[model samples]
Target: MGVDIGLEKFLATSDGVLVKPPQFFKTLQGKLKSLQRRLSRKQKRSKNYEKQRLKVARLHHKIDNRRKDFHFKQAHALCDAGDLVFMEDLDYRVSAKGMFGKHLLDAAFGQFRTIVKYVCWKRGKFFAEVDARGTSQKCPECGGEVKKDLSVRIHDCPHCGYKTDRDVADGQNIRNRGIKLMSTVGQTGMETACADELPGVGLTLPRQVSQPRKGKTRKPKK
Candidate 1:
């Protein structure tokens, strides 16, 4: 499984499934502001004031709990299904400094990453983090380039004529890259063992045999 973290939606998987973002904080912001205003009008240090103050705190706690519950459910579901899970090691600090800083913070990408890593570890599934730099910009189908900015939600690849939701393309790229890395590792291990068992077999390397494909994902290379 490859997970591409996003601000709009919580996650988009390589398989084209999307996990809709639960905008807990954004949804409750107005109510919180109203509670704060109400609390401000109450006499300072009085019983009524204390009660209103606790109400505000409780709202905050509720938001936190809901966000956490969503994360855990997502992480558990992903970890339970995939044999290997990969994601980009995105820097939330940098993301949080940009125009959508508040939105990103409310989404809490860091918290989700931690939960996913632990859940995968606890479930005995392989977990890997790859460089996120070009995953979003590359076309997963044809290994072609597709330049896009943050505002571009749909990816129209000029090179391969491929089209997809941007986050899904990113997730697909991450999964492809992870599989390539694992192939390299597996080949390295096999070369050593095969060389010892059979002398001449080490000279020629076999191609990366792929299964017969029916999906658009694994198009034959151009």
Candidate 2:
């Protein structure tokens, strides 16, 4: 499966499933702003200032934790959905500087992708990144150019008469690219091995290969 990440939605899969973004920061922005406002009015380095600052800090931390938790759950869900997962290889940091910068940063596409990759490894699913160029502009069905501006939400391919959500088309394109890349590298996508054993194979492996340690356990005295 291929995944497309965007500001409007957290991600849309090639399978046509759209996962709405929780936008944890945006949801809590008002409270965070109020806390910061209170912090600003406090005298610098005073007890009140310190207390307000910590409140603001805690709110920020809460947002981060919520976002991180969301990412992990989504990652695991993706791994569960498919044996192979693909995402566009793009520098989301550059996109974060645009008009929707705050939303993009809040979405944290890069961080989410990293979490997805790690989850795929842990769950024995294959994960890969494909070329990002023109994924949304090209037709997933006919490989024809279907030019449209950012305002366009639907992908109506004139050449192939293919219609679908724009993000879904992009996800399909990414999936095609990943499959092509795997073929180019001679991977049949059926290999089974631990991530450490065949890092480049990009196929499902046994679940026990990368099980994470659950807790810190003290060693018995010799």
Candidate 3:
């Protein structure tokens, strides 16, 4: 299976399934903003201030946990079903341009990709990062040029009359590239790609990420 990572829907598979965006921060915006306003109004050194600060921090933590859980579920389900999953190797630094770019960066696609890669290795499944340069512009069905703005959400190939969801078309291109890469490399190539690309995931087992944090220490009752 091949996948496209996008902000609208978290991921769009080549097979037409879309993992919907969680919009974690968006959902919590009102509560967080209210807490922030209340936090700002408090006396800096007061106990009430600290209490409100903790409440705000706790809300942030909740958002993070929910986001992580959503990503993990998607990764696990994809790895379970796919033999070799393909995805674009995105550069957040480059992609994070313009006013709202910081928001895009916070999506943490890099971290999600890392987790998915590690899981694939553990399960003895294949995963490849394909070049994303023209995957979206070129038509996967007919190899026809169908350049489009980000606003376009559907791919209508004038040449081959192939119509598909835009992100799904990108996923198809990613899958095709991965297949071509595997064909060129053969079994040895696949092994080399797995070892070289992931670097230590296959050798060093992945650690659990949900360990509990210890509370503040306290003196004995005296």
* Tens-digit lDDT string for candidate 2 (32-73): 989988888999999999999989988999999999999999
Candidate 1 — which residues are off by over 4 angstroms? 191-222
Scanning candidate 2 in windows of ten residues, the lowest lDDT window is 187-196
- Candidate 1 TM-score versus the reference: 0.81
By lDDT, the best candidate is 2
Candidate 3 deviant stretches above 4 angstroms: 187-222
Q: Which pairs clash in model 2?
A: none
Candidates' C-alpha lDDT: 0.89, 0.90, 0.85
Model 2, residue 134: distance off in Å is 1.0
Candidate 1 structure quality by residue, lDDT tens digits, 145-204? 888888999989998788889999999999998898899999999987777578565454
Span of 10 residues, lowest total lDDT, candidate 3: 203-212
Alpha-carbon TM-score of each model against the true structure: 0.81, 0.82, 0.80
Tens-digit per-residue lDDT, 1-222, candidate 3: 888988877788888888877778888889999999999999998999999999999999998888778778888898877889998888866777867574665577877888788888988889989898999998998788999999999999999999999999998999889998888879776787678467466444357655445997677896
The full ranking of all candidates by lDDT, starting with the best, is: 2, 1, 3
Q: Cα miss at 152, model 2 (Å)? A: 1.0
Residue 142 in candidate 3 has what lDDT? 79
lDDT of 3 at 215: 100
Candidate closest to the true structure, highest TM-score: 2
* Model 2 clashing-pair count: 0
Off by over 4 Å in 2: 187-222
